[model samples]
Target: MSLKPGNIVEGKVVNITKFGAFVEVEGKIGLLHISEISNSYVKDVSEYLKENDIVKVKIVSIGEDGKISLSIKQANLEEQKKSCKPEEVDWNSKKRKTNSIDFEDTLSKFLKESEEKFKDLKNYKNLKNGTYAKKKNR
Candidate 1:
């Protein structure tokens, strides 16, 4: 089968180096870089692959010089993403609950609280500056 980008193919690990393992896929040998080996840190390439270990890898890219870059971690991740189903959100399903409390009553309470807080702040500011503002007899 013809190898292309995003193609998950089974290949044989013919050689393993400190950096990565070279695998033969469809008679074409490509470099599976150490970074592409796994999602976690790979201290040694030999620990993952033997002299003749079959591995499934994703074709990352192909250079003009026929250099093919492969990835094992990406292959695993892509498979995981494929298996996962996206959650369908029902935007209009949940109806908004109507409040029984009167709007005017709530507004009046908020306004009264705000005015009291403002008056207290003003009194505090005047006291700090050593000046007392005369309160109007309401």
Candidate 2:
């Protein structure tokens, strides 16, 4: 089959290098770069793909000489669709249980605690400066 730029195909890894893997697709070779392997950061290419491993890859680029570049990330996304079933939800199926305090109440408590701390600090500063005095009732 003729490989196109948008086609996703299965290929056997023929060789692996620090930069990428050379995969053979229908007797034609393609470069599966390390960056194209996954969405996550890959510290080492051998950890995921190895020589002689068959993997599904998406055609990324086609050069003037027909050298193909492929991506494993695209292939995995396609495979995940096939193995997983669609989830359907009924509005009354189950009620979601909430396990948290009221947001406004939490904020008010935090503010009160902060004001007390600030007043304590101000009192300490005034006492250190010899200006602290007790207020008397008239």
Candidate 3:
């Protein structure tokens, strides 16, 4: 079958890299990017696939430069992914406003904590170097 977007096809893993694997389908080589290799976080591609292994992949996209992008996860998803579409969101909802406020507050809190830690680190360094004199009772 001709390689097209969303088309599930069988391809041979021609090469494997730290980032991803190259699969040859229909006499054309396509890059199965690391992100597209699996649904979960993949630390190593070799754990899931090996060179010359035949894999079922979904054609993700074909670039204007003749580059083909393939996805094994999408091939597995197929009908399930369509049925599990994310619920529609109201962009102007009150929840979004509250979330933004919460984010800003969290960021300020993080910055304050960071500054306090840095101050303590500086003081500790100074004390270790004998730059800070001990307070004597008056």
Q: Which candidate is the best by TM-score?
A: 2
lDDT of each: 0.91, 0.87, 0.90
Order the candidates by TM-score, highest first.
2, 1, 3
lDDT score, candidate 2, position 96: 53
Q: Cα RMSD to native, each candidate? A: 7.2, 5.4, 8.9
Model 2 TM: 0.73
Per-residue accuracy of model 1 over 55-131 as CA lDDT, tens digit each: 99999998999999999999999899989999998897966568766789999999999999999999999886664
Residue 68, candidate 3: how far off, in angstroms? Answer: 0.3
Q: What's the ranking of the predictions by lDDT, best on top?
A: 1, 3, 2
* Positional deviation of residue 73's Cα in model 1 after best superposition, in angstroms: 0.8
State every prediction's TM-score relative to the real structure.
0.63, 0.73, 0.57
For model 3, the local distance difference test gives: 0.90
The top-ranked prediction according to lDDT is 1
Error of 2 at 119 (Å): 1.0
How many backbone collisions does model 2 have?
0
